[model samples]
Target: MKVFDIIIQAMLSLRSNLLRSWLTTMGVAVGVFSIIAVMTALQAIDRSVAAGLSSLGANTFEIQKYPAAFFGGHGRNRFINRPDITYEEGLAFKRLMQEEARNIGLKVSRSGNQATYRNRSTNPDVVMVGADENFTAANGFDIQQGRNLVEQDILYARNVILIGHEVYTTLFPQRSDPTEQLLRINDDVYRIIGILARKGAAFGQSQDNLVVIPITRYRAHIDSRQSVGITVEASSRSTYSSTLDQAVGAMRTARGLTIRQENDFELRTNESLVESFRDFRQTISIGAFIISFMALVTAGVGIMNIMLVSVTERTREIGIRKSIGAPGATILQQFLLEALFLSLTGGAIGIMAGTGAGNLIAIAFNLPPILPWLWIGIAIAVCSAIGISFGIFPAYKAASLDPVDALRAR
Candidate 1:
């Protein structure tokens, strides 16, 4: 028989047992869906991490008490035991690196503080930061309105504050000028000096829910023991590497670390942050791959069993065809094609369902939808391989059947 005739016959056979065909395809679909959905979500997160580095301004690095991230959630106690980078030490480091760096910012932060403007209030999740004049230049914040914190603000420990876009919007919904307005953070009142530009959400949390005041005032009114984190910006991208190297030495000198002693403080940069996230993504991908492998293997076994049953049910038809001019090769070809068609159909459905489900995460986090083209291609190829691998034995059995015995079985 011609290949076209065999294909037509195979499709007709599947249609004859539509319910069984659909059920059998479901297993393959589920297997495909598991992998595709997980990969899609991971890829979306990967893109988000890269974009979120805008929080760390270009050519900027931070020196703090601990590393930016601790992968696998281990060794937290060991890092916490290290000494804090005191306010005195931060000032010394900034003075030491004054000539080498373009901008240097010192900060300490307290979260879960509410801001009140008249009777209006924000949720108790505002982050109040103690920052110096260089905070804007070093931390990627632009002044949307009013003047930014000047050197005098830090020199005298002024009560002047800079409110983020979200805080301003929450307190005054009418878009009125927030400068000179009294905004209360918990019990203390501060005069709003500037409004920071809007910075959208990162990791599902709004970056704009913030307030900044002079570091000295923060130390006086808030937690005095809190460690200071320092942000440093190079003059240009070309000077970033040299500045980063010099800043470490300057920090070590400021902390009075000898050549034999190990540095206690952590240094962080945008590149370092990306590397940390990459490790996290790899772990998740490995887990998804293992799960997908197991599911696909189970589904493949089910396909083989179903194909074997199909061949047995069609024995008489096979015998009748063999009794005439139909070749065994044609019977084998038809059975294989049927399995291939079934697998491909399931894969198609799975791809669409998985993509839609994964994109839901993007929508929730206000991130752009991502399509994993490489994974889709791999899914198609794997499905084809599974169809051929599992269908072989059943197709061979049907092709090798004895026409005389098959015809007499009824």
Candidate 2:
């Protein structure tokens, strides 16, 4: 038989048992959905992490009391008991690295606070950060209106704040310029000295739901026990490693660490952050792949059972065709095509549904939509392979049946 005729015959056979065919296809659909949905979501997350980390600008690193992330295992106690990087130590390190660094920024942050302007108030999801003049340049935040906090503001502990785009829009819904206005944080009323240009989102959270105050004021008015985090900008990319070394040595000296004592603080850069995320993403991807593989294997078994039943029911038809000069190869081809069609149909539907679901999640998290075409293509290929692998035995049985016996029995 011609290829097209075989395909048409295969499709007709499936259509004749529409309900059974659909149920069988559903198994494959679910399997494909599991693989595609998670892979799509992970692709979007990878894209978001890359974009977010790059937003911190180039040739920069931070020193803090704890690592940016911790993978649970041994040595948790050491990090837990490490001393906080004090404000005094931060300044002394700043003074020590003045000539070696291009720009040094100090910041401390507290989250889950409300900011009120007049009768309008933001949800308690607002984040309050204390920073100096270098914060804008070091962190790559641009002032949309008014000016960033100057050194004098931090030195004198001014009661002024810079609002992020989300905070500004939420508090001043009318789009009015918020500069020179007063906003209340706790019992303290602060002047809105500037509005930050929209910086978008990072890792599913808004980067713009924050308020910035001077570091000195943050120490004076807010919790003083929290460690200060310091950002150090290398003079150039080539010197970044050297600058990090200088920062480590300077921080050790400022904190009075001996040569034998291991450094208590953690230092991280954009490169390290990206590497950490890559490892995290890989671990999650492997887990998802394993789960999806199991589902697909289950679906393959279902396809095999359904195809075997199809062969049994069509034995007389196969006998009649073989009796009329039909080749065993043609019989095998017909059954194989039927199975392939079922799997591909399910796979096509699953791809559409999975992509839509993944994109919906991405939208909810405010991440850019990412279509993993490579994965989609691979899914379809896998579906085809599964169909051929599961259908071959049944197709071979149908093709090898004795024509007289099959005809006589049925």
Candidate 3:
């Protein structure tokens, strides 16, 4: 009659039908895994996006030739055909927004560059950026040593450069001073004017594997035809909106767009980027939840079917117990406990497996290990509910059985 004794009985019953119990438990495990793995991966992506978005400074936005991202390929070709944001237009826009904005930077970038210092060379994956003096403030980069590029560097299109931390380490592994060191990229030899502070990886890509050169030099000696990206920073957060409007108007004027004509350039910012990611996360979450719900419903049905069979098989046992004065509530409690044990056991296995699987994605994204605690807690609660909801009917059926008829049955 003790609760512990009833608990022991419930566990014993499950042990006696180990194969059936395990099969039912697996159903529950699958359901939990479906949701947990998805959520874990999504959370990892969110973390990476949050970190990567910091690459753009506060109250800063970018104006480029195309949208930051395009999905489903619906209108991808339209963006491709849009005219490049010419270097001249970028300069004109900068001049127009100069008074309204705190700083305006014109930049262009090309990837797959190699930098050489003495005999040491960086991997060909290095990015070469053409930037103005305001690049560090407009972007979220800081010079750790030496000095930023001056107005004369851009004015005369000098062969001066700022090396990123990765380049610094790769080329100067001996801890030798990098300031004023001569380096070569392409056929152009340049002197390093500054050393950059390390900006850690974002979404598995190193942020410190590039070098910055004056936009003038980049256009003259580097890739002249490449589209330029303009970065504009607002003086204050309160003025960010007005600053963006002013920048947009300036860009429109620079591009010679009429009143009926649409602006040809794209506006990209950390806020817009985060909002896009949030929408993506929401869509994926909904899909995962639906799949998990279906799996859980199937698992619940499996639990109910197995419990019904258990009741039928134990009809004589139930009659004997009732004849000996065991209460219906006690029988119900034992059955419910058995179901709960099965569901919870499965959920534990699923949680561990899902976390491991999802973290594989996080590792690939270069993100740290993450535990989706909220999803885990929800899984536990859901398992408990499934067990009780599915097990109660069978328990009631067993408890209400007539002693005479149950004893007569085989």
List model 1 lDDT by residue over 287-336, tens digit each: 88888788778878888898999988889989999999789999999999
Each prediction's TM-score versus the true structure: 0.90, 0.94, 0.89
Question: What is the Å distance of residue 218 in model 3 from its true position?
Answer: 3.5
lDDT of 3 by residue, 1-410 (tens): 79999999999999999999999999899989989998999888888887877767678899998776557467888888999999899889988987998888889999999999889999998999999998988887888999999899999999999999999999999878888879999778999989989998775678899999999999998779999999998999999999998888999999999999998889998877888888888889999899889999999999989999999999999889988999988998888888888889889988999999899988887777799999999999999999999988988888889988888879
lDDT of 2 by residue, 240-341 (tens): 888899999999999999999999999877777788887887888788788778877887888889999998898899989999999999999999888888
User: Which portions of model 3 miss their true places by more than 4 Å?
Assistant: 113-124, 155-157, 182-190, 201-205, 220-222
Q: How many residue pairs clash in each candidate?
A: 0, 0, 0
Model 3 poorest 10 in a row by lDDT: 66-75
Per-prediction CA RMSD (Å):
2.6, 1.9, 2.6
The C-alpha stretches of model 1 lying farther than 4 A from their native spots are 1-12, 15-19, 72-74, 201-205, 324-330, 363-366
Q: Give the lDDT of residue 376 in candidate 3.
A: 98
* Highest lDDT model number: 3
